[model samples]
Target: MATRRIISTEKTILDKDDDDISSPVAGQQQSSNTAPAVPMDVILKLLAFTFAMVVVPIGSYFLSVNTFFKGNSTYAGGLAAVMANVVLVGYVIVAMNEDQSDQLEAKKKAGKKE
Candidate 1:
Protein backbone atom coordinates (compact mmCIF):
# COMPACT_ATOMS: atom_id res chain seq x y z
CA MET A 1 0.00 0.00 0.00
CA ALA A 2 1.23 3.47 -0.97
CA THR A 3 0.48 6.57 1.15
CA ARG A 4 0.11 10.02 -0.48
CA ARG A 5 1.16 13.08 1.53
CA ILE A 6 -0.34 16.48 0.65
CA ILE A 7 1.83 19.51 1.51
CA SER A 8 0.56 23.11 1.57
CA THR A 9 3.01 26.04 1.67
CA GLU A 10 0.43 28.73 2.34
CA LYS A 11 -0.06 30.10 5.86
CA THR A 12 -3.82 30.27 6.40
CA ILE A 13 -5.56 31.66 9.49
CA LEU A 14 -6.55 28.18 10.65
CA ASP A 15 -2.95 26.98 10.48
CA LYS A 16 -1.64 29.78 12.71
CA ASP A 17 -0.78 29.01 16.34
CA ASP A 18 -1.73 31.32 19.22
CA ASP A 19 1.69 32.95 19.34
CA ASP A 20 1.78 33.58 15.58
CA ILE A 21 -1.80 34.85 15.38
CA SER A 22 -2.42 38.59 15.31
CA SER A 23 -5.51 40.70 14.63
CA PRO A 24 -4.07 43.26 12.22
CA VAL A 25 -1.59 42.28 9.53
CA ALA A 26 1.80 44.03 9.11
CA GLY A 27 1.61 47.80 8.34
CA GLN A 28 -2.22 47.65 8.57
CA GLN A 29 -4.05 49.63 11.23
CA GLN A 30 -7.08 48.09 12.89
CA SER A 31 -10.24 50.16 12.64
CA SER A 32 -12.55 50.72 15.57
CA ASN A 33 -16.02 49.07 15.66
CA THR A 34 -17.81 52.28 14.79
CA ALA A 35 -20.46 53.16 12.22
CA PRO A 36 -20.19 51.63 8.76
CA ALA A 37 -19.04 53.63 5.74
CA VAL A 38 -22.55 53.46 4.25
CA PRO A 39 -25.23 55.05 6.43
CA MET A 40 -28.34 53.14 7.52
CA ASP A 41 -30.58 55.50 5.57
CA VAL A 42 -28.60 54.82 2.39
CA ILE A 43 -28.88 51.07 2.99
CA LEU A 44 -32.62 51.33 3.57
CA LYS A 45 -33.09 53.44 0.46
CA LEU A 46 -31.25 50.91 -1.68
CA LEU A 47 -33.24 48.03 -0.16
CA ALA A 48 -36.54 49.78 -0.81
CA PHE A 49 -35.59 50.49 -4.39
CA THR A 50 -34.48 46.88 -4.88
CA PHE A 51 -37.78 45.61 -3.49
CA ALA A 52 -39.69 47.92 -5.79
CA MET A 53 -37.64 46.82 -8.76
CA VAL A 54 -38.65 43.19 -8.10
CA VAL A 55 -42.25 43.66 -7.06
CA VAL A 56 -43.32 46.46 -9.38
CA PRO A 57 -42.60 44.57 -12.63
CA ILE A 58 -44.31 41.32 -11.60
CA GLY A 59 -47.27 43.06 -10.00
CA SER A 60 -47.85 45.28 -13.02
CA TYR A 61 -47.63 42.25 -15.33
CA PHE A 62 -50.29 40.34 -13.40
CA LEU A 63 -52.54 43.35 -12.77
CA SER A 64 -52.51 44.56 -16.34
CA VAL A 65 -52.86 41.08 -17.86
CA ASN A 66 -56.58 40.85 -17.14
CA THR A 67 -57.60 44.22 -15.69
CA PHE A 68 -56.36 46.74 -18.25
CA PHE A 69 -55.09 44.64 -21.17
CA LYS A 70 -58.10 42.29 -21.25
CA GLY A 71 -55.95 39.11 -21.23
CA ASN A 72 -53.55 40.53 -23.83
CA SER A 73 -50.24 39.15 -22.58
CA THR A 74 -48.19 41.19 -25.07
CA TYR A 75 -49.47 44.56 -23.80
CA ALA A 76 -49.20 43.37 -20.22
CA GLY A 77 -45.58 42.33 -20.74
CA GLY A 78 -44.85 45.69 -22.34
CA LEU A 79 -46.37 47.51 -19.39
CA ALA A 80 -44.31 45.39 -17.01
CA ALA A 81 -41.16 46.30 -18.92
CA VAL A 82 -42.13 49.98 -18.81
CA MET A 83 -42.76 49.77 -15.08
CA ALA A 84 -39.32 48.24 -14.53
CA ASN A 85 -37.71 51.08 -16.45
CA VAL A 86 -39.72 53.60 -14.44
CA VAL A 87 -38.51 52.03 -11.23
CA LEU A 88 -34.90 52.18 -12.49
CA VAL A 89 -35.27 55.83 -13.42
CA GLY A 90 -36.82 56.60 -10.05
CA TYR A 91 -33.91 54.93 -8.25
CA VAL A 92 -31.43 56.90 -10.32
CA ILE A 93 -33.20 60.18 -9.55
CA VAL A 94 -33.30 59.42 -5.84
CA ALA A 95 -29.62 58.46 -5.85
CA MET A 96 -28.69 61.67 -7.65
CA ASN A 97 -30.67 63.76 -5.16
CA GLU A 98 -29.08 61.97 -2.22
CA ASP A 99 -25.63 62.45 -3.73
CA GLN A 100 -26.25 66.16 -4.22
CA SER A 101 -27.50 66.52 -0.64
CA ASP A 102 -24.46 64.68 0.67
CA GLN A 103 -22.18 66.96 -1.33
CA LEU A 104 -23.96 70.02 0.04
CA GLU A 105 -23.60 68.72 3.60
CA ALA A 106 -19.91 68.06 3.01
CA LYS A 107 -19.42 71.61 1.77
CA LYS A 108 -21.27 72.98 4.80
CA LYS A 109 -19.06 70.94 7.15
CA ALA A 110 -15.95 72.14 5.36
CA GLY A 111 -17.10 75.74 5.62
CA LYS A 112 -17.73 75.33 9.37
CA LYS A 113 -14.22 73.91 9.92
CA GLU A 114 -12.64 76.90 8.18
Candidate 2:
Protein backbone atom coordinates (compact mmCIF):
# COMPACT_ATOMS: atom_id res chain seq x y z
CA MET A 1 0.00 0.00 0.00
CA ALA A 2 2.78 2.43 0.78
CA THR A 3 4.53 1.68 -2.50
CA ARG A 4 1.31 2.20 -4.41
CA ARG A 5 0.75 5.57 -2.72
CA ILE A 6 4.31 6.72 -3.48
CA ILE A 7 3.97 5.74 -7.13
CA SER A 8 0.66 7.57 -7.44
CA THR A 9 2.18 10.71 -5.93
CA GLU A 10 5.13 10.55 -8.31
CA LYS A 11 2.79 10.11 -11.28
CA THR A 12 0.78 13.17 -10.23
CA ILE A 13 3.91 15.26 -9.90
CA LEU A 14 5.06 14.20 -13.36
CA ASP A 15 1.66 15.13 -14.81
CA LYS A 16 1.83 18.55 -13.22
CA ASP A 17 5.30 19.12 -14.69
CA ASP A 18 4.03 18.13 -18.13
CA ASP A 19 1.14 20.56 -17.88
CA ASP A 20 3.38 23.40 -16.75
CA ILE A 21 5.76 22.90 -19.69
CA SER A 22 2.90 23.19 -22.20
CA SER A 23 1.45 26.48 -23.45
CA PRO A 24 -2.12 27.21 -22.44
CA VAL A 25 -4.78 25.34 -24.39
CA ALA A 26 -7.65 27.15 -26.04
CA GLY A 27 -10.74 28.02 -23.89
CA GLN A 28 -8.86 26.94 -20.73
CA GLN A 29 -7.24 30.33 -20.20
CA GLN A 30 -8.44 33.80 -21.16
CA SER A 31 -5.80 36.33 -22.17
CA SER A 32 -6.00 40.12 -22.51
CA ASN A 33 -7.32 39.78 -26.05
CA THR A 34 -10.94 40.77 -26.44
CA ALA A 35 -13.21 37.74 -26.33
CA PRO A 36 -14.77 36.68 -29.57
CA ALA A 37 -18.16 38.22 -30.25
CA VAL A 38 -21.15 35.97 -29.88
CA PRO A 39 -22.98 35.22 -33.09
CA MET A 40 -26.11 37.30 -33.81
CA ASP A 41 -28.26 34.20 -34.23
CA VAL A 42 -27.55 33.07 -30.67
CA ILE A 43 -28.40 36.50 -29.33
CA LEU A 44 -31.64 36.55 -31.28
CA LYS A 45 -32.57 33.10 -30.03
CA LEU A 46 -32.07 34.09 -26.42
CA LEU A 47 -34.09 37.28 -26.86
CA ALA A 48 -36.87 35.41 -28.60
CA PHE A 49 -36.99 32.73 -25.92
CA THR A 50 -37.10 35.34 -23.14
CA PHE A 51 -39.94 37.15 -24.83
CA ALA A 52 -41.92 34.01 -25.47
CA MET A 53 -41.51 32.52 -22.00
CA VAL A 54 -41.64 35.67 -19.88
CA VAL A 55 -43.45 38.38 -21.76
CA VAL A 56 -45.99 36.67 -23.94
CA PRO A 57 -47.45 34.32 -21.33
CA ILE A 58 -47.88 36.94 -18.60
CA GLY A 59 -48.96 39.58 -21.04
CA SER A 60 -51.43 37.21 -22.59
CA TYR A 61 -52.94 36.37 -19.21
CA PHE A 62 -53.31 40.01 -18.18
CA LEU A 63 -54.56 41.24 -21.50
CA SER A 64 -56.84 38.40 -22.36
CA VAL A 65 -58.15 37.58 -18.90
CA ASN A 66 -58.49 41.09 -17.46
CA THR A 67 -58.82 43.46 -20.34
CA PHE A 68 -59.87 42.41 -23.80
CA PHE A 69 -61.11 38.85 -24.06
CA LYS A 70 -62.30 38.05 -20.55
CA GLY A 71 -64.68 35.30 -21.62
CA ASN A 72 -61.97 33.53 -23.74
CA SER A 73 -59.03 34.43 -21.50
CA THR A 74 -58.58 30.92 -20.22
CA TYR A 75 -58.14 29.54 -23.72
CA ALA A 76 -55.83 32.39 -24.73
CA GLY A 77 -53.60 31.97 -21.69
CA GLY A 78 -53.41 28.22 -22.16
CA LEU A 79 -52.49 28.64 -25.81
CA ALA A 80 -49.82 31.17 -24.96
CA ALA A 81 -48.30 28.83 -22.36
CA VAL A 82 -48.33 25.94 -24.77
CA MET A 83 -46.73 27.95 -27.53
CA ALA A 84 -43.96 29.17 -25.22
CA ASN A 85 -43.25 25.61 -24.08
CA VAL A 86 -43.14 24.40 -27.66
CA VAL A 87 -40.66 27.12 -28.58
CA LEU A 88 -38.50 26.27 -25.55
CA VAL A 89 -38.43 22.59 -26.41
CA GLY A 90 -37.64 23.32 -30.01
CA TYR A 91 -34.79 25.65 -29.05
CA VAL A 92 -33.36 23.03 -26.66
CA ILE A 93 -33.43 20.36 -29.34
CA VAL A 94 -31.71 22.59 -31.86
CA ALA A 95 -29.05 23.65 -29.39
CA MET A 96 -28.34 20.03 -28.44
CA ASN A 97 -27.95 19.04 -32.07
CA GLU A 98 -25.54 21.91 -32.69
CA ASP A 99 -23.46 20.96 -29.66
CA GLN A 100 -23.35 17.33 -30.71
CA SER A 101 -22.16 18.27 -34.16
CA ASP A 102 -19.48 20.54 -32.76
CA GLN A 103 -18.25 17.79 -30.40
CA LEU A 104 -18.18 15.28 -33.22
CA GLU A 105 -16.19 17.65 -35.40
CA ALA A 106 -13.73 18.24 -32.58
CA LYS A 107 -13.30 14.51 -32.09
CA LYS A 108 -12.70 14.01 -35.79
CA LYS A 109 -10.08 16.73 -35.83
CA ALA A 110 -8.39 15.25 -32.76
CA GLY A 111 -8.32 11.84 -34.33
CA LYS A 112 -6.76 13.21 -37.48
CA LYS A 113 -4.12 15.01 -35.47
CA GLU A 114 -3.33 11.83 -33.56
Choose the strongest candidate by lDDT: 1
**Per-prediction tally of clashes:** 0, 0
TM-score per candidate:
0.71, 0.50
CA error at residue 34 for candidate 2, angstroms = 1.7
Worst 10 residues of 1 by lDDT: 12-21
RMSD of 2: 8.1
- Tens digit of lDDT per residue, candidate 1, span 1-114? 999565687555566764354656776887778779999999999999999999999999999899998999999999999999999999999999999999999999999999
Q: Candidate 2: where are CA atoms >4 Å away?
A: 1-31, 37-40, 54-70
The 0-to-1 C-alpha lDDT of every candidate, in the order given, reads 0.91, 0.76
Deviating ranges (above 4 Å) for candidate 1 = 1-33
lDDT of 1 at 92: 97
